[model samples]
Target: MKRILTIVLLTISITVSAQTLRKYSNEFMNIGVDAAALGMANAVTAYSNDVNSGYWNPAGLVNLEDNQLALMHSSYFANIANYDYLAFAMPLDNRSAVGISLIRFAVDDILNTTQLIDAEGNINYDRISLFSTADYGVTFSYARKLPIPGFNYGINAKVIRRVIGKFASSWGFGLDAAIQFETRNEWKIGLMARDITTTFNAWAIDKDEFATVQNAVENQNQELPESTELTIPKLQFGVAKKFIYRHDFSILTELDLNIRFEQNNDIISTSIASINPAFGFEVGYIDMIYLRGGVGNFQNELQIDNSEKIGFQPSIGVGFKYSGIQVDYAFTDIGDQSVALYSNVFSLKLDFSIFR
Candidate 1:
C-alpha cells in the first residue's frame, strides 16, 4: 500500500506539471481553515467575522472588534494526511483591519523504494528510505470600509510553496479581491474572487531524484515534466440574514454560489462556467452556544450501471464561546459524499481583549 501510495503521489505531481491550467491545482488551500466554516459547508463568506475571515472572506475582517488569533487542525484519509491553520487579525482603526494567515497540508513518512534495487538488479531492503510531500500557504489580508455606508472591500496577497521530499519543489503567487455589504434591513452579502490575477506556480525538479522514477517504469516518465502550473480564477457569492428573537436567541442562515470557469460535475454546469450552491444555518442562544448544519459539494456521479446519480455532502457542528474564548467542533466528510469516513475538525479562537 505504501509503495502504491508513493507512486500515486509522484504520478499526480508529474501530471500537474504537464498541464498549464489545472482545474484543481493547489486544492489543498481550498480544504478550508476553521471548523465553523467547514461545518457550514463553507457558506460563511458573508457571515464570517474575526480572524478566520482572513481565509473565508477578507472583507469581513473589517468587522473585527478587537485583536484576535485562531488555530485549527484536522486529519484526512484516516490520518494519512494532516492539515493545520493559524491566523491573527486586528482592527487597525474604526473602519479598517489587517490579518495574516498560514496553512499547511502534508503527507509524511512515505517509503521511497526507487533505490531499493541496485544497478546490477540486486534487491536490498536496506536501500529503502522515507520522504514527505507538503504544501504551505501564507496570506496577507487588508480590509477597509468604503465611503458608502455598510460597504467594505478587502484584498489578499498569497504565497504558495509545495515540496515533494527532495525530488521537486514549486513557488507560487496570487491575489484575491473581496467585498461585503450590509443592507439596512440587516441582510449581508459578500463576493470573493480568488486567484483574481491567475496564480502561477513554477516547479523545479531534481534530475538525480527523477532519474530513479524514470527507471522504475519502462517506457514511462522518460522525459522531464513540464515546469509551470496555473490556477484560474474562481468566484464565490454569498448572502446571509440573521433573525433575533426576544434579544437573546438568534438564527443565521446563509446561501452561497461557487462559480468555476471550467465545466465539471457541478449541479449547474454550462460551457462558460459551473455553479455549486451551498446552504447553512446556525442557531445560537445568547451568543454563547451554537449549533450548525449545512449541505454542499453537489456532484453528479456515474453509477455502476452507467447511470448518473446526484450527491452532496452534509455536515454538522457545535460551538461554545465565553469570556473572549471560543471553541468549535465539526463532524464532516472532507472528501466527496461517497466517502463513508467522516473527519473530526476542531478550532480555537482567542480575543486579545481578554488580557486587557
Candidate 2:
C-alpha cells in the first residue's frame, strides 16, 4: 500500500512536474501571511497594516501612525519551508512614511540524479545528493499623502538574488511603484507595477568544479557557455473594492492580474502566462473578527486536482484582534491531486498597531 501510495504520488507529481520550479514563484512576497494568501493575489490593492506591507502594497504605509517592526515565517505543506520578511516603517509627522524590508525563500534537500552505466554492463543508480533553492531580496519604500489629501503614492527599490543548487546564482534588481486614491465615501482604488527592471540572467555553472570521478552527469568534461543571465519579463496589476456598512462592518474584494512574456520550462519563474488572475474577498464585523476566501485558477493549464479537472484553487482564513495586536490564519486547497495528494495550506500573521 505504501508503494502504491508512492506510485500514485509520483504519477500525479510527474503530471504537474512542469510547474515544480515556478509554482510557488510569486510576485506578492508575503505568501505566509494568511489574509493575503487566502485571497489569491487580492492583497495587492488590499490594505495591509502588518510589517509584511513591504511586500504586498508598500503604499499602504502612508497610514501608519507609529514606527513598528515585524517578522514572519512559514512552512509549506510538502516538506517545503521558507523564512521571509523583516521590516520597520517610520511614520512621519505628515501622512508620509518610509520603510525597509528583507525577504528570503528557500527549498531544501533535493535529490540530484544522473543516468549512468556500471562495469557490469547494466544500469545502476550512481549517486544521490542534496541541493537547495534559495533567494533573498531587500526592499526600500517611501509613501506620501498627496497635497490635495486623501490620495497617496509610493515606490520601492528591490535588490534580489536567485541561486540554484550551488551550480549557479543570479542577482539583479527591480522596482515596484504604486498609487492609491481614496474618497470620503470610503471607496479606495490602487495600482501597482512590479519588476519594472525586467530582471533576467542565471549564474554561469563552473564545469571545472565538478565533483571527482563522475562520468554519469551530463557534460562531465566540456567547455561551457560564457556565463550568462536568464531573462524574465514581469508586469502584474491588482484592483480592490471595499464596502463598509458601518464602523464595525466591512466587505473587501479584490482581483489581480500578471503577465509573463517569456516561455520556459523551469522552476524559477511563475508557471502562469505572467498573465493570470486571482480573486478573493474578506468580510468582517467591527474589525474584531473576520472571514476570508478566494481562488487562484488557471483553467485547464493548471488544475488543483486532475481527478476533478478543474483548477479549484480555493482558500479560507480568519483574523482576530486582542488589544492593539491582531492575529490571523488561512487555509488553502490547491486543486490538482488525488485523495492521497493533499495540497492544503495554512499560515499565521500578527499585527501591532498603536491606534486604539
Candidate 3:
C-alpha cells in the first residue's frame, strides 16, 4: 500500500511539473467555461439502457431502446444558474438513428444597478433587484450503426447559440463522432471525438460608452468571438471491463484519457494542461440500485488558478433506477486553500425514458 501511494504521488508531481495545455478548458466546471471537460463512465453513461448515449458515446446509441427521450435537471449548490439537459433519439429500422438535444445555463436573481450623476457633483444610490438569464448550445445528430459483430459507430453535429438576457444572440456549431467495440460479454471499449469545430464566436462585446458599474460587457454580448478564433475540444478515448458477480449483479471499471490542443509554459501554469487519466468503478446491485465512486486527476497536478490548468479531476457519484427512470448525483472538489473551498461542485441528473 505504501509503495502504491508513493508511486501515485510521484506520478502526480511529475504530471504537474511537466508541460503544455490540453484543450476544452481544464477545471471550468468550478472556475469558468474553460475547465468543462467531457464527463466519462457515469451510470448515465453506463451500459444497457441506451437512449442518450450520444452525449457519452455516440456509438452507444446503436444498442439503446428504440424511440426514447430523456430529460434531466440539476441545481448547483452555489445558488448559480441551474443546469439542464434534454435528449431524444429514435432508431431507424434498427440500423440508423436520429437525435436532438439541448443544454442551457440559466441563472436567477441579480441586484440591478443604476448609475446617475446628480447636481453639484452629488450622486444618489438606487439599486433594483433584477434577474437576467443567458443560455447557449443546441445539438442535432444523426448516427448509423455498423453491422460488424461487436462493433458500433456514429456521428453528430451541434449548433451553438449564444443568448443574453434580451440582446442579440450569436451562432456557431460543432461536429462529433464515435466508435464502440465489445467482445462477446466481457469487455467494452469506446473512442469519441467531441466538438471538432469548437469555434465560439464572441460577438456583442460591451461598448466603452456604457459607464454603468454593472456587468454591462457580459450582459450586452451573447456570442463573443474568441481571441484566437477557434479553440477545439480535447479528444477522449476510454476502455472498460465488466464482471458479473451474480446473475443480476455486476461491476464495471473504466479509464479515460484526454488529449487537447493546449500548450503549456513551464512557468505559472499556462493552461494547467496535463495528460488527464481517470479511473472509475460502478457496481449495479440488482436492476434498480447503482453505486459509484471515482477519483479524478489521480496522479495529476492540481491547479485552480486562472493562469494554470488541471486536466485530471476526481469525482464520486451514486445513482438508482426504477422501471423506466433513473437519477444520478456527483460531487467534485479541487484547488488549494482559498480556491479549494470555492472549487467544490455538486451535480444532479435525472433520466426518464420509455420505449414506443
In order of listing, the candidates' clash counts read 0, 19, 21
- Model 3 Cα lDDT, one tens digit per residue, 241-352: 8888867998778876655556543222236444455567777888677667654443323455644443334555566667665665555443321223223223333333
Ranking by TM-score: 1, 2, 3
* Cα error of candidate 3 at position 336, Å: 8.4
TM-score, every prediction = 0.94, 0.71, 0.70
- Model 1, 1-356: lDDT tens digits are 66556666676666565465554678888888888888898899998988999898999999998999999999988899999999999999999999999999999998888877778989899988899899999999999999999999999999999998888888999999999999999999999999999999888888888878777655555556547778899999999999999999999999999999988999999999999999999999999999999999888888999999988888999999999999999988645485446889999999998998
Candidate 1 residue-wise lDDT at 72? 98
Greater-TM-score candidate between 2 and 3: 2
Candidate number achieving the greatest lDDT relative to the actual structure:
1
How good is model 1 by TM-score?
Answer: 0.94
Ordering by lDDT: 1, 2, 3
- Go through the candidates in order and give each one's C-alpha lDDT: 0.89, 0.57, 0.51
Q: Predict model 2's lDDT versus the native.
A: 0.57
lDDT of 1: 0.89
Better of 1 and 3 by TM-score: 1
Q: Which is the better candidate, 1 or 3, if ranked by lDDT?
A: 1
